[model samples]
Every structure is written in C-alpha cells, then in structure tokens.
Target: MSAPGEKAASELPQRLWLNGRVLEGRKDFERALENASEQERPVLEFGLRWCSDEPEMVLHTSGSTGRPKEIRAKKICMAASARMTVRRLGLRAGDTALLCLPMDYIAGQMVVVRSMLAGLRLVARRPSRRPFEDLARAPDFAALVPLQVLSTLEHEAERSLLAATREVLIGGAAVDRALAARLASFPNRLWSSYGMTETLSHIALRPLSGPRAGVWYEPLEGVRVSSSPRGTLAVSAPAVGVSLIETNDLVVFEPGSDRFRVLGRTDNVIDSGGIKVPAEALEELIGTVLESPFAIAPLPDPELGNSVAIVVEGTPDLPLPDFRALLRGAGLSPYWKPRSAVFVERLPRTRTGKLDRTALREAARSAPGRFRRAL
Candidate 1:
C-alpha cells in the first residue's frame, strides 16, 4: 500500500469532460490547464494529478468548529464517495454538473472527481456569493453552501435555477429555521450533507425538502455510526478509509439504527440550571424571526450559575418581551427562553465566516448595559 502523495504517475484518463464539451487527448487538457485562471489553476492541477496513479490527496478542514487542520484524503475513498453520490443522485454519463464552490476544499474537489467518475459534463465556475449568475446551461446537479442557498432564494431569477436543478447538495453549515422553511417547497430535490474534510466529504445525508423533509441524517452506504462516552458522535466509514473519526458534534441516534439528528456541538453546549441548551439549536429556532446575524449564548449569573442571552446585530428592533414571546410561542421552555438581549453593530465572525461566539461573549460580558436591556 503506497502512502498518499507517493504513488507514481501511471495511467491517466483518456479525456477530460469539462464546460459542456469533452477535451480529447492530453494536449487539449494541457492547453485548457494553461488557460485556467490563477484561482482555478490549483484545483485543476490537482485534478490532473489526481487522474494519475496517485492514491491520495491532502485536504484542509473549514475551521468552522475550531481550527482548520490538514489531513490526507484517499483517492480510493473519494472514488467510493463519488460512486455513492452517483447512485444516490441518479447521475448518469453525459449529465450536466455545475461546480461553483472554491476548489480548495473537499466539497469543491469532490465535484470535480464526481464529474470524472460519472462521466458527467463538468461546468466550472468561479465560486461567488451568487453562483447562479451569468450565462450558463442549467445544471442537472449542483452543490452549494447554506449561505449561498439563502442568498439565492432571495432573488426570483436566481431561485428559478435551483428549482430547475435536479438535485442540489447543501452543506458547510447548519440550515437555520428560516432557510429550512423556504427549502420545504423548493422544487428541486435538496439534501443536507453531514461530514468533514477528513471524511472526503459526506458520510451521511438528510433530505431538507420535499416528501422526505425530516431531521434525521441517514448514513451513507457502508458507514457505521456510534456515540462516545461524552455523548458526541463518532463515524466509522471504510469508504473514506477512516476507522473512527470522533467528533465534538452531539447527536441523538435512533433507538437501534444508524440514522441520527444532529443537536449541536459539545463545545457549544450551554448548561443553564441543569438543562442542556444547545446554542446552535436555540439559534436555529430564533432564526425564524431575526434576519441579521445573531447567536444564543450564556451569561454569567449568581442564581442559575448561567443564564440564557441573545446577541443580535444592530439595534434590537423587537421588544425584549416579544423576543421571549417568540421563543415561548415556539414551545421553548422558560429555561430555554433568553432572559436578556444584547445588540452589537455587527456579530463577529472568523476569517472563514464562522460565528465568533467567544468574541461576542467577551463583548457582552464587558459592556453589559450598552447593548443589553431593551433596544
């Protein structure tokens, strides 16, 4: 067994199907590669190398949970993942697939690989805030982030593309309640992928729209699921060559099945008066009302040890009592309802666009009154 980045270049694929046309012969591809933009060059180079006898590839995590880490993604694992996607999505040779995500990440890389394996026509587009913009044939399949979906649905012209798409995979972040509601009737088949860079992409998928709309994430074929002592989720998928990648994500598995519903992350747990409140879960619930960035966090308190609080972007327009009323109206317990609300000009986010909860907590702690109480 050769290690990753060590396999000697042996047989290369006959042709590269790209941008609605098949590039025959290596010379044609070399010319296309030379013309690739700086942003697209690296992944295109990677795709070329991956087509060789190389057994593995290196991919980086998104750092949404914490810090980004480099890990090896086995080429064999990627092929398996591609096969699973093709089978599950009903993709066939000559199908049109769109690639609008950054080629640096696994999500983007897999799009390229899937096109090759499934013999689909790959249409490459630079990743952007609105991936559906400009002139291009409607894609039979597409993959996107939740943020992109949110932005796309806001525009009638852009959203029609989603409706025309046969299947669209949404990942990279949890879908908030507001977005999920819009996805419920979204004409296309929408799926929420669950996995990380280490797993080569997703080991499980949950339907976000249509007849199968539900909370459970059904693991991919040949993937096993279990729980750690701390109640976090663990994955064992041979397709990805990962024996067990223990994750900080907390989930509730079905009584005796592999399907599970992701609750939140262990690190994001807010223990308020013995009741475990998943901040992300609460945030999703509150997302139905608040449009701007906001987060649910714990505030220091003497009696309960920790109290529920919310930090929203800009001046809080909704009255404090109304906010609580919304939570209560949604069946949130008194303990789950936020006791205090804080407003910030902007909710801090990490370089990767992840919510900087730690920073927001500090800001709320230091200047309690400035943004606290009512608007």
Candidate 2:
C-alpha cells in the first residue's frame, strides 16, 4: 500500500456522490482537489503519482475535555476495517449505502470506505436535523451517530427511512438506553459500534436486537481483546490497527461468555476515603432520582481528601433533603452522596457535544458557599 499523499498517475480518480446527484466526474474532482489543496496550503503531494502506497488520513479528536489534535492512520488499515465490517454484516456487492454523517469524522469516512470496498453504490446527503428526510432514496445500509438515530425516531418520515434500511450502525457517542429501546421496534438490523479515532473506527460491534441487544462483542476476525487488571478494555488487531490500543473505558466481564458491557471511562473515577467511586455510575444512579441531567465530579475536601459533588443542568423543584433521601434509598453510601448540589442552567459541552469536564471542575470550585460535605 502506498503511503498517504503518494498516488500513481495511472490510478483512477475517485467519484463523489452528493444529494441525489453525481455532481462531478474525475476531471472535476481533480480540479476540486487542487482547489482545496491550494486553499489549505497543500503540505502533501497531489494525485496518484504524488500519493503514497499507504495514504494517511488525519482524524481530529472531538476535544470534549481539551483542544482537539489530528491523529494519522494508514489508508490500508481503513480498507481492512471496511472488509471486516462487510463480512460481519454479510454485506454483498452492489448494495446501496447512505452517507449522512459529516465526512470529516471517522464514522463518516467508514461509510465511504465500506461502500468502496463492497462495490456498493454510494448516496451522499447533506447533514440535517432530520438526516433521513431528504435521502435520495432508501438504501440497503447506513451509519448514524446516536443523536441522528434519536432524531429519526421522533420523525415519521425519518423513521420510515430507517425501517427501510437493511443494516444500520450507530456510534460517535453512547447509545442511550431510551433511544435503543425505540430502535428495537423497527425491523432493520441495528448495531452499536465500539471504537474511536485512534482505533480507525470500531474494533468491536454489538448488535442491538435479537437476544443480545446490549451484551458482548463479536469482535472482527484477527482482533484480540483482553481486560487489564484495572478492568480497562484493550485491543490488538493486525488488520484494524498497528498496535494494541488501550482505552480509558471500564467494562464488566461476563463469566463463561465472550461479551462485556462498557461501564464508563476510567478517568471519571473518584477516590474518596480509600474507596474508588465511578462518577459515571453514580451520575446514572442520581439521574434516576433527580428530574434533570447532572454530572458528578470529585471536588477538594480537606477531610476526605477528594469528595464528590453533583452539578445539575437546571434548577430543581425538589428540596435538598428530598434529593439526599433519594440517594440514601438508592444505597449510595453516605460519603458517596453529593457534598453539595450546585444548580447551573446548562453544563458546558465541547464542539462534538460531549461534556466539558475541565470547565465543569472550574465552575464547581467557583460556586459560592455551596460546599457542604455529605458525610
């Protein structure tokens, strides 16, 4: 495989399908490439001759917690990933696929790569709030982010398009349980992809229905998975990536089974009074008892060293004691309950719509006179 930026002049130019029309052919595509290259100050060479055997594509992290940077992955690995997906889903040549995600992300790139590798026709559509509404036509398969899936569930036209699709893969963020339940009512095969920019998309796919809606992973062939002593998930796939990727996610292993359920991120764990508490697990527990969305983070506590605090999305109508009692009933140890419950209109989010933890911590520290230890 040629490295990124080294393309042979003899190689055929790639096509672009957009909004129900094949707007540009090879020559047109070349012109557009030159245009973008000039605008972006082309650091890499141009075209087949200039392109490498294994072309590199840079994926930018969403930067939910900090600034985003580009991570490079080989084009050959992407093709391998596409081939694995085709075999996993039983996709055949000539199948039709809809591309609805922003082409800038890994999820969107996988759609195009899969279509190319499978000899399937591609239909590219503009990003919209109603993603499936303006589809050129119903397709055999498609990939969506979680938010897009939720939007489809709420709209009749989008839902119809979704039902017509043969296979659908959803990722980019956690697939909320409520949204997954809504998708279960449909006839299409729904899958939740588990991966990241570093892994070149997903190394594992968990089906969304039929006895294993949210269970273990049926890993791609050649992908090796193992858990660390700390319960973090790790992967080594020759065709998928160059090296073993260690994720910050925590998982629960099922005895006598090959599957595992992702619990939360390891970075979110808080150590208080010699006990390790997963802030995400507590957030979900508190989310059930509270009326609105909230985040749990470790705040400085002179006594316990670091104590947990709750930050709500909006003002709560319930009393402080009521909230505390709910947690008590839920079996959160006295020390695990919020040291203080702070009300903020909305939690800060990153460009990719994930919680901004760094900013949230700062906000927690600046809140006036709200520090009261629960224990």
Candidate 3:
C-alpha cells in the first residue's frame, strides 16, 4: 500500500453523489460547495479536504470518557480502512451509501470514502434524530448511531425505510437490551460496530439481527485482537496502519477464538469498599427494570469509599423509594444496588452522542442535596 500523500488526487474517487446531484472532479465539487446549504456544506467541505493534496487529516476523539482531542491520521491509512469495510460488508459499486452523520466525525468521513473508492453512490443528509424523514428511496447501505436507530424504530415509516436498507451499521454507543430486542426481527442485516476514531471507524462488528446475531463482536478481516494485562482490548490492524492500539474498554475473549465481548470501561468501574462493580454491567441489569434512559454512576462514600448511584434522564415517574424497591426486586446483589438516585432533565452526552462520564460524575458531586436516598 502507498504511504500517506504518496497517492495523487488522480488516484482518488472522481465521482461524488451529494444529496440528489452527481458531482464530478474538483471543479464540480468546488462549485457545489460555493452554492451549498448549511446542511450540505459539511459534506462538501470534507469532500474538498479529502481531495486536497495533504497526506494527513485531523480527526477528533468522541470524548465520551474524557476530554476530546485532535489526532492526525494518514489519508492512506483511512483509505485502507475504507476498503476493509467495503470488502467485509460486500458493498458493491453503484450501490447507494447514506451519509447522515456529522462530517467532522470519522464515521461520516468513512462513508464518503467507501462510496468513492467502491464506486457506490453517496446520499448525504443532515444529521438528525430522524435521518430517513425526507428519504424517497432506500439506500443499499447506511450507518447510524444507536440513538438514531432507536428514534427510527419508534416511527413506522422511518422504521420501514431502515429495514429496507440492505445493510446497517450502528455505532458511537452501546446498544441496550431493549433496543436490541426490538431489532431482533428485522429482515435486513444490522450490526453493532466496535471502534473509535483512532481505529478510523470500526475494526469489529457484532450482528444485531439475523441468525448470526450474538453478544460477541467479531473482528474484521486484517484485524487481530488481544487482551492487555488489565483485561482491556488491544488491536493490531496493519491494513489501517495500526500495529497496536490499546483501549481502556474491558473485554473478555471467547476462550480460544479471537471474538470478544466488551464488559465496560475500566475507568467507569465503581470500587465500593473492597468490591469492584462495572457500571455498564450494572446499567444493563437496571435497564431490565427501568425502561428509561439512565446511567450507573459512582458517588463518594466515607465508609464504602465509593457507592453506586443511578443518574436518570427526565423526571422519575415513581417515588424514590418505589424506584429503589423495583431495582432491589430485580435480583440485584447488594453491591450492584444503587444507594441513591439523581434526576436531570437530560443526561449529559458528548458531541458524538456518547455518555459523558466525566461530566456525569461532576453533576453527581456538584449537588449533594439533589440526590434522593434509595432507602
């Protein structure tokens, strides 16, 4: 594979499908950008960047767990990442791929790159909860965040449009049990992606629907997975110029197989007294009892060192005691049970739509009076 900047502009994709129009070459792309609407500008701007003479592009981390930062990635590595996805998903040339994510993000960038490289037509849309609102036809493939998928499933029309898409990739956040259950019957192929900006997009995919659907995430071709000393995931994908990228996400492998299951972030764990609890695992159990959007957070405790608390979005429908009782009845161990609850109008999220744990912790600590004791 050619190094970054080594490949000339002539080697890049010459055709682009912006919205409903076809743009060819640098002149066509530049013309469209000059006359582009606010919604269309991001796509066009990124298109211009991709076609630039620069060898590297600036990308941002999602900042779900920490502060967001910029990282420079080789264009050649990105192209290799795009090709891996195209081959793994069987995306054919002339097929349509939807671009509904923020162009500044890696997911959106990869969609455009994949379309360009594979000769697939690109369909750009404004990023919104209802991405399929103005769609006139189904796309051959589409990429969406978990929140968008959940929103689409709520409405009949949008849900049908999503189901008609030949392939769908869901990422940016974990897919909860309730949402996964609803997707089990979809006729089309739906996958939950596991990756970050550092990996270009996703190095692994877990099928959300079909007979192949399961809890484990299977690494894509040219990708290898291993566990760190701390049990976190480590990846090595030479195809994307990644020799090894260690992650803070805790994972468990399938014994002898390369397949793995993400348990939760090691930093998100609550060390209460001498016992350690994974916040995500606790949240998954809590989700079965409470259907609302909520997160398991750790609160300071003098005796236990740290105590588990539930941060719920919007107003709690039931009384604090009643909510605690419901969780207790759900067969939770003493360690997993939340000692208190906090209610906010909306949970804090990063720009990429991931739970902002750092901000969430600040919220829980800033207002002690707001906490309602579970007892």
Candidate 4:
C-alpha cells in the first residue's frame, strides 16, 4: 500500500462529475474554469489544486474557539479520510453527494474530495439555510450544518426532501437539544459529526436516529482515543496522518470503552465562586427551555469571582424574574443560574456560525448597563 500523503498520480481519480458537467483530467478541468460561475469557481479552483503535483492542500480553521488560521493538509491523508467515511457509510459509485456548505471550509471541501475518490456524483448547491429548496430529487448522501437541518425541518417540501435523503451528516456546530429531539424521529439515517479542521473533518460520529442514537461518539475504525489528564480528548489516527491531536473538548469515556461523550470545551468553562461550570453544558440545558438565541457567558462578580449571565439576541421575551424562574425550573443550581440577563441586537458568532463565547464575555464586561438583574 502507498504510504500516507504519497498516493501515486496514476492512482488518483482522473475525472470530476460536478453539477451535471463532466470534466476529465487536469487540462479539461482547467479549461472549464474560465466560464465557471462565481459559485462554481471555488470548486474548480480547489479541484485545480487537487489535480496538481502538490502533495498538500491549503485549508483554514473555523475559529470558533479562537482565531482562524491557514493550514496545509496532506492530500493522501484527505484521501484516507474520504475512504473511511465512504466505506463506513456504504456510499457506492454514481451516488449523489450534496455539497451545500461553503467550499472554503473543510466540511464542504471534503464533500467534493469524497465524490472524486468514490466516483459519486457531486451535486453543488449554494450554502444557505434552505439548501433543499427547489430540489427535484433527494441526494444519496449529504453533509449539512445544524442551521440547515433546522431550516429544512420547518418547511414541508424541504423536510420531505430531507427525509428522502439516504444518509445525512450534521456538523460545523453543536446540535441544540430541541433540534436533536426533532431529529430523533426522522425517518432517514442521520448522524452528528465530531471533529475540527486539524482532523480533516470528523473523527467520530454519533447517530441521531435509530437504535444507535445516543450521546456518545464512536471513533472511526483505526482511530484511537483517550482522555487527557485535564479530561479532554486525545486522538491518534495515523490512517488520516494524525499521529496525535490534543483537543480542548472536555469528554467522559464509557468506562473501559473508547466511546466518549463531549461535555464541553475547557476554555469555555465558567469559574463562579468556588464552583466550575461548563458554559456549553449550561447552554445545552437552557436550550431545552429557551426558544430564542442565547449564550451563557461569565460576568465579573464582586465576590464570586465570576457569575453566569445570559446574553440573548433581540429584545427580552419574558421578564427578568420569570426567566430566572424558568432556569430554576430547569434544575439549574443557584450557582449555575444567570445572575442577570443582557439583551443584544444579535448574539456574537464565529464566521462558521458557532457561539463566540470569548467575544460575548468581553462584551458583557465592557458594558454594565446592558445587564438587567432580577430583584
């Protein structure tokens, strides 16, 4: 077998079937780029690089936790990653794989790569909340963000199309409790992907429906996982060229089993008084009750060191006292309850649509008048 990152040119796929157009070989792919539309250019440009003699491809991080940075990913490793997913999902040649995510990101880029390697037909669509709008037929497989999934579920036509899709992978952000509960009854196969740019997409997947549906994520075959001293996840999957990646995500393993459940990110932990609370965990719990967009952030406290605050998008729906009562009703401890609520025009989010907790915390500290405390 060829070593990782060293696949021979002859072994690579020679043709790309993109959006009903067949472009064979590097020369043909390059020729079509001149007349490609704005939406088609990103795919063709990335395809151009993939067809080149370069061993690695340039990609960028989502910057959900911090700053987004560029990284060079090995093509051989990407091929390996594609193969793992294709094999696990039972994707066959000539199957249609939907590409509705932005090509600039790994999740979107991997869809194209997976199509090329597996000989699957690539169905290109602009990234949007309504990705399934006006679709004549459902794709055989697809990768979608949580927002897209939510939007599709709201409309009858789109929801039907989504139900008809053979398999679907939801990623790019955490699926809120409400959305997960709705997806639990979905007729088709649905999975939530757990990974980042460094892993070149998802290293683990949790089924959202069927008998396998649960909180724990099962790592892909050939991937090894362990909990770090800080209770974060550490991964080693050489098949994808990842020797070891120490992630900031806090996780708890299933006793001796490799399966694990992500609690939250350690960096997003809120230290209130002497107790430490995971912001994501609090937000997930709050999501079950709150219907609006909100984030749990740490506010500077006089004695408790840091106190939890709810930053909500748009105007406040319920009064401050009622919101506090709701939290208490949801089983939140006194320390876990938000000391106050802040109303913003919009909640801060990363470019990839993830909650920007660092930004939200800074905004809360910089502005005091925005916070309305419950008497």
What C-alpha lDDT do the candidate models reach, one value each? 0.77, 0.68, 0.84, 0.85
Worst 10 residues of 1 by lDDT: 5-14
lDDT agreement of model 4 with the native: 0.85
What TM-score quantifies how close candidate 1 is to the native fold? 0.86
Choose 2 or 4, whichever is better by lDDT.
4
74-130 per-residue lDDT for model 3 (tens digits): 877788898889988999988999888988789988998888788888887888888
Task: For residues 122-231, write the lDDT of model 1, one tens digit per residue.
Answer: 87877776888873546999998877787787888888888889989998778766787888897779999998888888889999888988888998888899988988
Reference-based TM-score of each model: 0.86, 0.79, 0.93, 0.93
By lDDT, who's the top model here? Answer: 4
Instruction: Name model 3 segments beyond 4 Å from true.
Output: 1-10, 316-332, 368-371
Q: Is candidate 1 or candidate 2 better by TM-score?
A: 1
C-alpha lDDT (0 to 100) for residue 30 of candidate 3:
93
Model 3 clash number = 0
Deviation in Å, model 3, residue 256 alpha carbon: 2.5
Between candidates 1 and 4, the one scoring higher on TM-score is 4
Where is model 4 more than 4 Å wrong at Cα? Answer: 1-6, 317-332, 366-375
Regions more than 4 Å wrong, model 2: 1-17, 21-28, 31-54, 134-137, 287-291, 316-334, 363-375
Clashing pairs in 1: none
Tell me the tens digit of each residue's lDDT in model 2 across 134-240: 66457888888766776687778778888888999887766655566667666778898888777888888888865667656667777877798778998888775
- The predicted structure with the larger lDDT, 1 or 3, is 3
